[model samples]
Target: MKRYTKLGLILTIIVTCFYVTTASAQGHYNVLKYGAKNDSSKLATESIKKAIAAASKAGGGTVYFPAGKYLTGPIHLKSNITIYIEAGAEIHFSDNFDHYLPMVKSRWEGTDVMNFSPLFYAINAENIAIKGRGLIDGHGKKWWAYSEVHVKKIPTSRWQEEFKRLNKDVLAPDLPGWIERGFLRPPFIQTMDCKNVLIEGITITNSPFWTINPQYCDNVTISKVTINNPDSPNSDGINPESCRNVHISDCHISTGDDCITIKSGKDRSGRKANVPAENYTITNCTMLSGHGGVVIGSEMSAGVRRVTISNCVFDGTDRGLRIKSARGRGGVVEDIRVNNVIMRNIRDQAIVLDLQYATTTVEPVSERTPAFRNIHFSNITAHGNRAGYLNGLEEMPIENVSFNNMNMDMQTGFRIKNSKDIEFHNVRVNNKKGPVVEAENVVGLQIDDVRSQKPVAGEAIIELTNVEGAIIQNAFPAKGTEVYLKAKGAKTSDIVGKANHFGNVKTVVIQEADVKEKIKLD
Candidate 1:
């Protein structure tokens, strides 16, 4: 075991103590009583807002809400205030549509759009908290009603007319491009240009659009929150759009769209905005059901960088840890680290990095470039049914991709396309069927301690096309076709594991006598 220095040991002890002490002291908040009888509903919103405002004015304190069903429109939060709710408190949004008018700056699918303001909207604040056990329900039925009415081909002219009618008060000529594109619609908690925000230990459910949209913020911490949104059409759980220095930990998110999507911005407008969403850390979270678990982008044209996720579980999700971007969306996603993840029953690829996203028409590849490089995954265990695909486009081949100590029990093969500087260490694919590792248009590839179960009848376990400077050092045999390497113009290839290196790049078929020790799985 590695040794720690004296200062490191002292700091670790102090941090553990501080965490326990602070957790104990967290539930101390003054409760102001309000009922729905003594003009209760009318005074509840103002009372709660006043409590939070008083806390903020007094230089940071807690505002407590006891058990009750309080009706309100929009509850604006303030800096240096903590809103704590008891476990039985159920704060409900008013069902009236007019209660939530006056649109806010938000988005959906990378489009800047508008609709009813969120139930809890804060702007440009600092050191805020919404902690403790309770529910903040954004009664989203009205918003969903509008969505269902709009999606099913409502005659183009009629749709435009309805949009104009709904947004009559919106500044017509000055509305942004996203407003025109029908994005920036609505969400539950839209916080823009805020700093040092803390959202911990709350249940947020039934959001209109993106559940918790944090745009252009810094030093935000979202922990131990259960986000539940099952309805379709723009019900994302937690979208960190154009934010920096975020840490999301110990959250269970199940939503209709991407569970926890990281977005910088979208398209040329996003690029022109020029705000890079960077330095996010997600740990100890569980993703139950969603389009994808912890997705990076289809909306990352501005940029996304330096993300770290660890000790997470993805179950029954479409994909586990996906990084996707399209062509002409100029962004660089680099230095991503995913470690200690366990994925089960993945509907799609266990780990996927695709550069061409949302392009079903398959246009001619000309000006499509999105740089993906330096991504590392380690100590991951997966059991799934689909293929594991890592695809980079012709113009933007991936660079420095590494998968170390991965044990995958899968049903399909693994593929890599148009990539460079890839490494796989101690990687075992128990496909036991066929095509374990396939690479095309690759360069600087290395596979160490890679083993697979062969198919009953097929080609080699490894296939290479137009790849250069590739090395397959070691392999283990199970059944079908063992290890085959085919490269037409591939040069400078070396295969040296329990076998000779240097010369004769032909089929150096080494027998079991020349193989190394077998691994023991307990």
Candidate 2:
């Protein structure tokens, strides 16, 4: 009798432990349990918040929403939690402007300010994720309509009045005057100062502003996501600002603005933060109908470096592989490498490096001077492009840019200005205009095995002005070309050529009256 009693006690203990382990493993806090009604008419804001709080208090677990439509406002995420919307579930953000009240710390167009909170926000959290094959609708029509009425193209008189009001309300606002007084919209999903974040397998639509924006975060992975916002203004697909160690892969983005823009900050505010968006790897992404395929910034004031983009396809984009910044935005963008990129139906330049992006006047060389260097492009093929423009600033010229194995079919060929240490190897452009290659104010230029096809007027195939230390070797111009090389400038010297075939003509024109020394040709 004593032995049987001891065996029974052991069995009871084993059964109790099994139940505990099972409960721990399946710790899913359903929103329905927290008074969240699945009816589309009801607002599930408080219930969802309760669910998140309960799960967080219980050492973190999944906040699950079953197959139904849950309408809410501004879902805030916490640490050590995962919000999983099951298949056929949808989270629709309400259009109530008052619901996003009590502004939070956020960035609007690269400037830090206290604004309306993002649709989904998180701060100072770790190991947070929003995953599942569901849908997130931002209900952005109201925001878009509001911006059109108040923000876009305000009258000059109204602008002055608004500026006065902004200065009076907020002391020294950094953003534009039009966007100062509650005109700037919030992003769809924003996480600041968070770590170990994962956003995967979700279809997002109609964002109020930028779709996925992560600022000052680390170890972020965004994969298998689809963003479809075709007509909303400023609806950028994914923008990573002041973040590090990010990976964006296998995303299909078709937005109204830039597909993917990497930035740090904008102006003085950006320089004060002193954090750069670096160490990013973007691969196997499809960009469609955006401003640019993969843009660096018009707002990168806090130096961006060490980014690699490969195996991407850009169709019907305005520009491909663009980097733009103005004078007052002081940053150094370097070590950017792109390979195996194919572009079609490009509306503007296939590749652009414009240091004079927005501002027209030149400023003194200081910490605010923008610089681009050490950028390399290889194995790129572009068709139906207008031109390839590489215009740098006179004060701070673009340096150390290389292009290899490029085949372009465009209306005009390359127009390089105010650059140094440029090289083009095995490059071909079937341009439709004369003067296929034009270079001005260049230093240390080299063109190897470069060819152009069928000039219309037999004009000079390559035109050089104010260039120094130029080497042209193994260049084959088209037949009926008037001049193989036309060199003219006071500073043009050391122009050398070897093994070049000047088809049907061998005329080299050098205006050497004001040249410092005679040009050397071999």
Candidate 3:
């Protein structure tokens, strides 16, 4: 080893520090250095792909984009590659649809198809990441113009015949024409059949459709990402389909559709695949201007389970914490727990669990019947149009759902229909319209410390129709309560109330004279 002088060593140390701090260091392949134009004038698609090839050939390195605007088409990511965009750097994806040519295999809207490639795509890869304090713009104005709202038939919908190969048991007749109808928009960043994926610290905007979609992926973590896509059609922020071990935190999402959606697959294909989207933990997220804050299904056919959502705030979303599935989608949504969530300015119900989401036809219990059960919500506060809506199926009613310590101030109250084994503890709904709890065709309903703070005069505080067994205890009712409880319908029976202070209630219980034997206070 040769000895160095003090001055030379100091200079060498400073240079080493600078090189280590730079994003385009020796181990990193810089896009600009690989003939990628930094200006947005030229297409850098080939150069960026070349840089990724270099990095991947070198046994995995970072492909760096440093402090400039890069115009590129589709970016295909390989395994063991990291795309790092430094601060002040932006990647503008081309709007020309031809750039995404050759029609890669992609799962569009819970159906597998060979459609347009995503802006950034990967398949069957592992240990991939796209993380930096930078921006990835899809430049989706041209794509949005292809929507059916403006154009009747989009060019992307030409793959209808191809979709039939993957899934022939299509329930929706319009599934094939979805692309032509401009219903299936390509995702911004999509990874399929991959593992150990991460997307962090990036700001994504102007996505064509679902921004970050991961299909058949595992060990995915998306954190500290800011996604804003306002007034754009089908621009869901993040959708993880048939994925497991997903962790999403510290994200701020405001999209036209759902902020975060979980899907498995579509009807029979999903069941045939038998891959459930499970083991998800979503916490510390802020959602605004989206259709739903955290939505599940409307596409779950393989089943969705073991999901935990905590410490999330939803503002200006149409609905918050929703789970909806329709008939012909044979799946079970169970073992879901939500805690410490706040919702305000919700256009629809704060929490909704509906089995009749996209279909209206009633079918018999079979492999095509969807079910919702074993869901629990606690420590939730909301100010919305309605507190909650739980509408189950006539054949298979929702089962074993409980809500505890929920406080809400809404224009309307909670609506529960076609459910069983439901419990509400320490729940308060302050609404201006209708009854606090309007439950119909319910069996085994339990209300403990539950009441309407502002009960309407004419409408009963709690209306029960065709209810089999209802037990109310430890209730806290405010003054000017006109009717504490009302029971009706031919099947209504076994209304029990105990341990309640009823000094302010004008009427304790009201029973229809015709069904007096069927409905009475015990």
lDDT by residue (1-522, candidate 3, tens digit) is 244587788899999989887745446888998999888889999999999999889888889999989999999999999999999999999998778876788887877766788999999999999999999999888888866656776554444444444334434422244633533558999999999999999999999988999999999999999999989988999999999999999999999889999999887668877799999999999999999999999889899999999999999999999999888888999999999999999999999999988756677799888899999999999998999899999998999999999999999888999999999999999899898888999999998888887788787888888898888888757999988888888888878877888888888788886445644343
Cα lDDT computed for each candidate against the true fold? 0.72, 0.84, 0.88
Flag clash pairs in model 3: 157-180
Per-residue lDDT over 103-142 for candidate 1, one digit per residue giving the tens place of the 0 to 100 score: 5554555544455567788887887778889888877775
* Candidate 3 regions with alpha-carbon error over 4 angstroms: 1-26, 149-183, 514-522
Alpha-carbon deviation at 200 in model 3, angstroms: 0.3
Instruction: List runs of model 2 lying over 4 Å from the truth.
Output: 1-26, 148-182, 504-522
Which rank order by TM-score, best down to worst?
A: 3, 2, 1
Query: Model 2: which ten-residue window has the lowest total lDDT?
Result: 166-175
Q: Write the per-residue lDDT of candidate 2 for residues 20-118, one digit (tens) a residue.
A: 788668578899999887777789989999999988998788888898999999999999889888888899999886788667777877777667779
How many residue pairs clash in model 3? Answer: 1
For candidate 2, the TM-score is 0.89
- Residue pairs whose backbone atoms clash in candidate 2: none
Residue 459 lDDT (model 3):
76
